[model samples]
Target chain A: MKIALAQISPILQDVRKNINRHLKLAEKAKKERADLIVFPELSLTGYTLQDLVPEAAINPNKDDSFDAFRLISKEISIVLGFVEEKGKGSFYNSAAFISGGEVLHIHRKVFLPTYGMFDEAKFFSQGKDISAFQTPFGKTGLLICYDFLNYGANYVLFSQGADIIIALSAAPGRGINENDAFASSHMWELMGETVSRFSTAFVIYCNRVGFEDGKSFAGGSFIYSPEGTAICRASYIDEDFLIEELDLSLLRKARQKLMYKRDNKPEVILKNLYRAVFKNED
Target chain B: MKINTVFVERILTKFIKDELGKFHFKKAVLGLSGGLDSSVTAFLCAKAIGAENVLAIIMPYGESIKKDISDAKKVVKQLGINSKTIHINPMVDAYYSKYPIQNRVIKGNKMARERMSILYDFSSREKAMVIGTSNKTELLLGYGTIHGDMASGINPIGDLYKTQVRQLGKHLGIPEEILKKSPSAGFWPGQTDEKEIGIDYENIDNILYQIVDLRKQKKEVAAMGFSQKTIDRLVEMIKNSEFKRKLPLIPKISERTVGHDFLLPYDWGK
Candidate 1:
C-alpha cells in the first residue's frame, strides 16, 4: 500500500485557511495514488489556541468543516487533525480518519503535554482509550503528539492488529540545542526506533513545518519500514509530500523474528524498570 | 560589575541538585556544540548536578568545522565534566545522500536535525534528561527547531534573555572565549545567526524585552526610537510564530490531561 505523509504549514486560528490547505494536500496525496495521507496534530487550527480553543472548536459530524476532506478521502484515507466538540461544554483535540467519504473514526489525543510553553491542559481534554481505524489499506492506529513519547497505549493498538501507525504532531521548541532547529527530526528518529522495535509495522509521522507560535517546526516527515529503515523522508523547513510503498509482508517477517512481546511482560522486570526509574510514590 | 560567583553558584546548585533534584533523575545530558548556547548550558548542568552526574556529547558533522571541536573541548576542560565527541559526519552525509538536498538553507537545517539525532541517542543510552539551551530572545523570535533543538526534558535558560544569558555566563564564571565569541548556530562555518536573521543580538535583545515579555505595542516600541521596520518584524515574528509556544494540541476526549484538562506541572506530584 502507498501512504503519503503531508507535512503542511497551517495558519493559526484560521480554520478556513487550514481546511483549504488540508484539501489541497489531500488532493496532492490523491494525485500520487496514496492509499492514506497523514497530517500534523491540530493542523486545522494551529496548536497554540489556549483560551481561543473554544472559538476554534468544530464538530466533525455537524461543523461542515470536514466535508471537503470527507469527499477527498473517497480517493484515499485521510488522517487530518482538528478540534472536535465532545459534550455540551467540553472538546477534544482529535484526528479524524476519513475513508470513502465518511468519517470512519476519531482518535482524541491521549497525552496533553503542559510543561514549559505548552498550555494544552488549559484548553483541551485527554482521550482515554487507544483507537484503531479500519481502512481499505489496513488496521491503522492514530495518535497525536505527546502520546508519541508514550508507547504503552500505542502498543495496545498494535496488539489489536493495527498494521500501520500514523502519528500527527506539532512539536515546538528546540531540543538540547540553542534554537528550535533540530529537535523535531531527532524526536522522529526516536519515534521510529520505538515504533519499529515494538510493533514492527509501517510507521508514518507527519509534522507541521514553519513557525507557528514562536516555535519553528522542522517538517522531516517520513515513513519507517518495519525493519526500522527510513523508506522516504520529506524536506525540512518547507511543505512537502512523501509518498512511498509499504510492504505488509515485511511487518509479518519482522514480527516473527522479534523475541520480546508486549503481551508477555515479566511482572518482576516490569516492576523493576518502573520502580528503579520512578522510585517511591506508588 | 563584580561577578558574585559564589552567590550565583549557590542558587544554581539549589535549583539543579536540590530543587530539580527532587526528581532523582539518573543523569542529565547536554549537547555541547562548543557554541555559546551549549557551553553555557553545559556549565549550568555541571554546576546544577556535579560533573559526574552530567553527560556532555560533542556532536559535530562535516560542516561543524575544527574550531567547534576545540571550543567544545575547552569548555569540557574548564568544567571538568564527563564528555565524549561523536562525529555525525558519516550518518548525516549518508542521510543527505539518500535524500539529496541542494539549498544551503535546507542543508543547514538537516545538519541541525542530524546533530540532534545523535544527542537523543546519547540521552537515551545514558538515561539522562535533555537540558535546553534556548534563551528568551531565540524563543520569542521562533529561532529554534521543533523537536530537534527544542524538545528537551527541561529548560533552565529558557526564561533568560540574550543579554541576561551573557550576564549569567559571566556570573557562572564560564570561559572567556565562550563568553566572548560571536554567537552562531554553527550550521555553516561562515554563517552566523545575526547574518542570517539580519539583526544583531544587542538590538534584538533590547527590542524583544520591550515588546514580547513586556507586552509593549508597536507605537510604544516606535516611541523608543527603534525603526518601524524592526518593530514591525519583531511583532510579526511574535504574533505569527505563536504556535511555537505550545504542545502539539490534542483534541480533548478525557476528563483530565496535561494540555487540555488537568493543566498540572510534570512534577506536580512533588
Candidate 2:
C-alpha cells in the first residue's frame, strides 16, 4: 500500500479555504497513485479556533463541504481531520476514513487536552470509544491528536486485529534542546516507534505546519515501519507531502517476532482498568 | 534549551505575522534600548511585519549613555526601519525636579516609566502596539520596573532568557559590540544589570532552567551545584515577581470571581 502524508498549513477559522487546499493536495496525491492520503488534525480549520470552532465545524451527515472528498475517495482513500458538529452546541475533534465514495469511520478525539496550550475541553466533546474497523486496506484504527499519548488507544486497536494505525496531530514544536532540535518531535518519534514495534502495525503520523494564534505547529509527519524503523519523515516547520510504499508482508513477520499483541490478556487489562478507575467500587 | 537562530527566526517571524494579522494590525512599535533584548525584538519585528511597518523609537534621558543611543541608531540604520529620536529628558526631569527624589531606585523607576510612556505615545500615533523587550531572566528576577518595561501589546522575546537572547542576537548577526556589552537599563549613570541584581545572567539562567523549566526542587537545584543562598534568592525573586507575569489578583468573594473561577480568556468569544 502506498500512503501519502499531506502536511499542510490550514487557514485559521476558514473552513472553505482549508477544504479547497485539501482538495488540491488530495488531487495531487491521487495523480501520484497513492492508495490513501492523510491530513493533519483539524485540517479543515486551524487549531486554536476558540469560539470560532462552531462556525468552522461540519456535520458529516449533512454538511455539503465534504462532497468533494467523498467524490475523490472513489479512486483514493482519504483520512482527514475536521471539527465535527454533531448538532448545535456539540462539537468534537474528529477524523474520518473515506473510501469508495463512502464514509467508513469517524473517530472523535477521546483525549481532549485541557492543560498547557490546549483548551479543547472548553470547545470540544470527548470521544468515548477506541476500536478498529474494516477498511479497504484491511483492519485500521484512527485517532486524533493527543490520543497517542497513552497506551490504550493503540493497544485496544491492535488487540482488535488492526493492521494500520493512523493519527492526526496539530502539536506545536517546543523546547529546543542543546542540539537546537524540537524535544516534542523527539517524543513523537519515540511514540511512533514504540507503538509500531509493540503493536506490529504500520504507524502513520500527520502533523500540521505553520502558525495559529501565535503557536507554530511542527510538521514532522512520517511513517514508521512495522519493525519500528522510520521509513520516511518530513522536516519540522515546513509543509510537505510524503509518500512511501508499505510492505504488508513485514507486518506478519513483525507480529511473529514480537508476539506482544498475540499474548492477549483482555481480562487482565479489564481488571487493571477496574483497579485504576474503580478503586472505590472494589 | 538552545535553538537554531534561522529556524527560530522563521517560526517567530511567522508567528508575529500571523498573530498581528489576526488582530488586524499592520504595524509594530517598540522602544529601541540599544541593549541585546531590545535589539533582538526590533530585528524580529522588522523581519516579521516588515521594516516599513516597524517603528523604532529611541527614548533617551538626559543622563542616558551616549553609546546606547549610538547603538540604537545603528540598529535602525542597519535594518532600514523607520525611527524617531524622542528626548525624554524634559518629561522625566520635570517630575523629579518637583519630587526632589534622592534614591537611585526611585529615579530608575521614573526613567523606565518615562520611556514606556514615550513608546505608548508613538504606539498611539503610529497605530501600533508597544512591543516589549524584557527577556525571561529579567522577568523572572523582577528586575524590570512593573508597568514600565513589562508593558507590551505583544512580546516575542519574553520567553527567551538573557543567554538565549545573546544566542539569538548572534544568530541574527547583531553587531558584536552590542551583543557583548554588559546589559544596562541606562536609567542612571554607570548602572549595570549584574551590579544591581548582584548576580550574573549565566548563573541566574542556569538556576532558573533547573527550578522553573526543569521543575526541580530546591534540594535538587542545590545538588546541581548552586549555592543555597543563590537558590533561595532566585526562588524568592521568582515567587515575588509572579504578579508581574500575570493579571492582577481578584480575590474571590462572590460566586464568580474575575481572572479566577469565572475566567474567560481572550479567545473565549462572546
Candidate 3:
C-alpha cells in the first residue's frame, strides 16, 4: 500500500486554520497517489489544551470539523488525532480512522502522561480498552503518544490480531545527541524499531512539528517494516509529507520467521498483573 | 525569585545532565564570575555532570576586584572541580591599544566579549560546552553584553531570575559572602549591576515576571505599582537587545532560505 505521513504544525486552539492546513496537505498527498495519509496526535487541535480543551473540543459525531477530512477520505484513507467530547464535561485524547468518507473506528488514548511537561491526565479521561478494528488496509490498531510508549499497549494490540499499528504522537523535540539535534526523536525511532521487530507488524508513527508554549514538537514521523527496518522517515521540525510504498507481505514473512505472537502466554502475564495489584489477597 | 530553590536545583541538574548526556558530552565549561548567577550555574553543573567534569575558568580583567577572584577560587575549592585562571587584561589591552575607544561602557563591553572569546577557546580545547550564566532578568533587560557572557552552548540558569539565583545559591551551599555581595560584572572598580541599570533587581524581577511570564501589558504592569517610566525603560531595553537572543540574520534570497525556510535544529540522530 502507498502511505503518506503528513508532518504538520497545527496552530494552537485554532481549528479553522488547522482544517485548512489539513486540506492543503491532503491535496498534496493525493497528487502523489497515496492510498493512506496519517497525521500526528492532536493534529486538529494543538497539544497544549488546558482550559482551552472545552473551547477546542470536537464531537466527531456532530461536529463539521471532520467534513474536510471526510471529503479527503473519499479519495484516500486518513488517520488523525483530536479532542473527542464524549458527553457534557467528558473528553478524551483520541484518534479516528476514516476511509471511504466514513468513520471506521475511534481509539482513545489509554495512557495519559502526567509527568514533566505532559498533563494529559489532568484534562482527558483515560481509555479502558485496547482493540484493533477492521479497516480497508488491515486489522489496524491506533495509539496516541503515551500509549505507544508503553510496551504492553502494543502487545495488547498485536494479540488482538492487528496487522498494522498507527501511533499518533505530539512528542516534543528535545536533547542534542551529538550528531542529531533531536535526541528524543531518536529515542522514539528506537522504540519504533523495537516494537516493529517484536510484533512483526507494520508500524506507522506520525508526530507533529511546531513550537507550542516554547516547547518544539519533533516531526520525525517514520514507518518501519516487519523486519524492524525503517522504510521511510519524514523531516524533523518541519511541515512536510513523506510518501512511501509499504509492503504488507513482509508481515507474514517476518512472523513466520519469529512467531512471538503465537508463543506469547497471556495467562502468565495476567496472573502476574493480578498478583501485582492484589499482593496479599492473591 | 520566590520559587522553591531545592526543586529548581533538582530539575535544573537533571536537565543539564540529560542534555549533556544526549549530546555525548561528559564535561561542561563556564566563566566563574563569583557572582550569584555563575555561582548558581557552577553548583548545578557540578551536581549534574560531576565536580570532576565541570571546568570553572576564572577570567579576571585589569580592574577586576581581588575579593571576587578569591570568591571564585573558594567555589572551585569547595566543588573540587577543574579550575583555570586566565587574566584577560593582555587581550583587552591589545585591541584597544591599536584602536582606542573613549567610552568606558564601550570598553567594558569589549572586556566582556574578550571573556567570551577566552571561554569559547577553552571550551574547544577541553571539549566542554560553554555554560551561560546570565539569568532571565539580565537576559530580558539586555543587561549583559551580547555574544559575550550571554553566549553558551546550553544554559542551565538562563531561565532563573536574579532573586531565584540567590535562593539557588543558598540551596547549593554557595558562600554567604558571595551571595550577600552586590552583583557586579567587575568591568571596572566599584562597578555594580544595579548602579549601571539604575533599578534594583527586586523591582526588576517583579516587573519582568509580570511582563514575560504573566504576559501582562505595559499599562497593566504599570498599574501593578511600578512607575510608567521604569516600565517603558525596561520594555525599551528588551526591544533593543532582541537581536542578541537570536542567531545571526540570514538574507532570504532563495526560496529555501537558511534561517527562514531551511532551519536545521541539529536534531538528525543516527
Of the candidates shown, which would achieve the greatest TM-score relative to the real structure?
2
The DockQ of each candidate is 0.02, 0.31, 0.03
Per-residue error for A180 in candidate 3, Å, reads 1.8
How many clashing pairs per prediction, in order?
43, 0, 4
lDDT of 2 by residue, A196-249 (tens): 988889999999987665566888998998889999899888789898898888
Please, what is the TM-score per model? 0.52, 0.89, 0.56
Against the true structure, what is model 2's DockQ?
A: 0.31
Give lDDT: candidate 3, residue A63: 91
lDDT by residue for model 3 (B1-270), tens: 366565456557756775676567889999997778888889899998889999999988764488888999999999999999999878888888999888888888888898899889988898888888888888887778888888887777777788878877887899999999887767678888889777888888889888887789999999988999988988999999898888899878887876675532232120
Which residue pairs does candidate 2 place in steric collision?
none
Off by over 4 Å in 3: A280-282, B1-270
For candidate 3, what is the DockQ? 0.03
Clashing pairs in 3: A180-B268, A181-B266, A181-B267, A182-B267
Model 1, residue A190: what's the lDDT?
77
For model 2, the docking class works out as acceptable
Instruction: Order the candidate numbers by TM-score, best to worst.
Output: 2, 3, 1
Give Cα distance to truth, residue A189, candidate 1, Å. Answer: 1.1
Q: Give one digit per residue, the lDDT tens place, for model 1 in A50-142.
A: 656777789887778888888888888888898888866678899889899899989998888887677677678888878776788778888
Expressed between 0 and 1, the share of native interface contacts present in candidate 1 is 0.00
